[model samples]
Target: MASLNVGNLGEYLREQRRSAQLSLRQLADAAGVSNPYLSQIERGLRKPSAEVLQQVAKALRISAETLYVRAGILDEKERDELETRAVILADPSINERQKQVLLQIYESFRKENDFETLSHADADVDADVDGSGSDARPKQSPPSS
Candidate 1:
């Protein structure tokens, strides 16, 4: 039999619920779903509808859009928009380099209102080393000697 690579929406939901320190029963109660049904969904035996996914996401304190993406239900443009928004929202403390990059991105979007024109090369300016380790920033060279 051919193998199937089903969506991981259920797994993602389960993981998020666990991370939030909620039990299956608690999550089901909060989500207004049946415990057994939630369990089956977590075990990959049942696929949840978009409405259920949104409910679960609300109960888990996660974005419904993210759940939709995990469920493979979001369109390409929506997925990209969600991913970009996630990047901006994931980090609360923006370092100087990150702030600069964000500013540049904002300016570029303001000028053209196009994200496709933004390139990794355009953002590579210097090396950013923080507690999280090194990430390549836009390359900046020393002033001429």
Candidate 2:
């Protein structure tokens, strides 16, 4: 399995910034950082703190949680999500907007699958509660044999 790579965070950030049509200096100003500092961050030469990532995320009009995951500040089940997005963003096969579209579709599919799974699970639980599931309920004897 591929290990997590925070280096891709820089590229992802840069992609987000550009999609917003913000130049390096513009993003730096918006995020309250020096231009050189932001440049270093985008170049993957520097790792930004949580606060910095938050500020940058806010400036880009995106969720800070995404930045937190990318920065390795929020390591948990969220890592898979962020890493999947990072890989999508890094893929050269698709362009930026296409990547965004694909990500949205992927998320929707996951949600739909989860919903279906839960619905099935809930049906099973309901059946159990009602003792109506096959092999669960008591069988009756034949009458007038």
Candidate 3:
């Protein structure tokens, strides 16, 4: 029998948990799952159901839609639809630059939907400190000539 690739739900969960500084045991306890089960899931040896994924996402303080996306329940088309809806739901006053950035991000996400591999470094947000004491925002300045 052919094995099914359920996408990277487990790895996504594991990364999110680690990013949140939570241990496997801690995540398992909070998600009402066993450490071994969680470990297997993280290792891609087991697949979790939607309900379980939802519970785990809730425990990790992430949106269930994120979990669904990781689980391959939301395909590229659906994700694009959601992104379009989200952009529409945002303030109409948003500038063209903001829309361009959002489109770039969405395209990058769609192109790098691999489960086993991490997305490109473009997904990372750089923190820059200005001498003017403003909070760090996304690095949008053009490179010096």
Candidate 4:
């Protein structure tokens, strides 16, 4: 019953195709999809599956994971993590060992944040169950007569 967010994916695909100097028909041929179907996808009249997106990404010489993220198949957090790892791995200044260490540290920090978020949520739930609202404001006494 809900509309899927495919418009952004379509726009992104069009942009990538254009940037690669390829026409809709050419891209469709390269991606092994029909021209009309690719056009429909670009117009947001169709939602392509992950395999289709992967084929398109290959035709465009782009990352399939990026397309997956734009197509809403992957979470934004996953994209962020992948991008961070890519940056770290691509940095020529860092040695391979250093890059591995940095990635390990980054992963640990992410896990720590996830744990803290869960702990805070649990605390809020406990506060609600105990008949004290989740708000942390201190209770105030009425003014004396």
* TM-score for each of the candidates: 0.53, 0.50, 0.51, 0.78
Residue 90, model 3: lDDT of 76
> What are the per-model C-alpha RMSD values against the true structure?
12.9, 11.8, 15.9, 3.6
Taking the tens digit of each residue's C-alpha lDDT, what string does model 1 give over 10-48?
Answer: 678788998999999999999999999898788777778
Task: Compute the lDDT of residue 10 as modeled in candidate 1.
Answer: 66
Candidate 1 segments whose C-alpha is farther than 4 A from its true place: 1-7, 82-145
Choose 1 or 4, whichever is better by lDDT: 4
Clash pairs (backbone) in predicted model 2:
none
Q: Please give the RMSD of candidate 3 to the true structure.
A: 15.9
Write the number of the candidate with greater TM-score, choosing between 1 and 4. Answer: 4
Could you give candidate 4's per-residue lDDT for residues 1-145 as a string of tens digits?
2345688888899999999999999999999999999988887778899999989999999998888888879988998899899999999998999999999999999999999999999988988877676565666899999
Error of 1 at 98 (Å): 22
lDDT string for model 3 (1-145, tens) is 2323653776677789999999999999999999998887787777788788878988999877777777777776676567575765475787778777777886687667753244333233232224222354555788989
Better of 2 and 4 by lDDT: 4
User: Cα miss at 116, model 1 (Å)?
Assistant: 8.0
Best by TM-score: 4
